[model samples]
Target: MAANKAKRPLPSAQPMRHNPNPQQILRPQYGLRISPAGSQPQRSRLHARETAQLMPVKAHVYRTIAELNGGFEKVIQDLQTLRQISFFRNDRVTAMHDLICRVRAQANRDFTMTLHGRELANAGHFDGLCIEWEKQIEDRSDT
Candidate 1:
């Protein structure tokens, strides 16, 4: 014969405390504290400055010289447009110009490293064009 076991009673659940000011709840996951009603939260000047700067659009590496040339043309047009806009800062414009120069340099470097003999010789014209484009971008950024 098996002996019977006695069960213990479950403990009662405690009620959650209600918060009077719901807006002041701490949210650790978001890394932002909700300010109390009527008072504004302080923001850093760096954050405001960054928000004003124009972010560059994503660009892909072009495999062909034609594509690279087209990309450069598009960037130049964009820089020109940015200059005309009253809101864009000059430093931001210079940063964009520097980005374009870097892209051109990378393309040229890749072409030189990947090709040799006749292929390299054939791209001599393109090398000269790249130099001219770099000069143009620098001149535009300076003004």
Candidate 2:
């Protein structure tokens, strides 16, 4: 029994089959390198304080009719672009309508000021543009 046992090979003694070229071999040549901590630049407190102290600026207020009319042209272009994008269409349209109403109010105020003897350059042009924008808003609302 001792002689037979000695001739028998152990199960764990089988040779391992290795590929000549492994597909997922770890190549140490392409490994990442760790940089020294002293190589990084330091941030200054002055820059941080400067950024923190900055105040939020408000939107430009249109004082004259011509300026408001020019702004209206830009708003029309923006509204056209917004309409092309279908996502959140109703909300954007409502916001644009509100903006148009605010512009019309400003135009009315300018007209009132003109009645009080204040001269406004390009008042006729501005009035025409306001009328055109009102018609556009009406057309859009009808749909």
User: In candidate 1, what are the lDDT values of residues 37-118, reduced to their tens digit?
Assistant: 7876644564444334423222222234546566676677678778777898978897897888788888777754655433
**Alpha carbon lDDT at 81, candidate 1:** 73
Clashing pairs in 1: none
Model 1 C-alpha lDDT versus the unseen true structure: 0.58
RMSD of 2: 35.0
Query: What would you estimate as the lDDT of candidate 2?
Result: 0.54
What TM-score would candidate 1 get against the native? 0.35
Which segments of candidate 2 are over 4 A away from where they belong? 1-64, 111-116, 119-143
Every candidate's lDDT: 0.58, 0.54
Q: Can you give the TM-score per candidate against the true fold?
A: 0.35, 0.29
Give the poorly placed runs of model 1, Cα more than 4 Å off.
1-63, 117-143
C-alpha RMSD for every candidate: 30.8, 35.0
Expressed as tens digits, the lDDT of each residue in 1-111 for candidate 2 is: 133222232233234678745533422223223346666443356544433443322122223444556566667666766777778576768688678868777877876
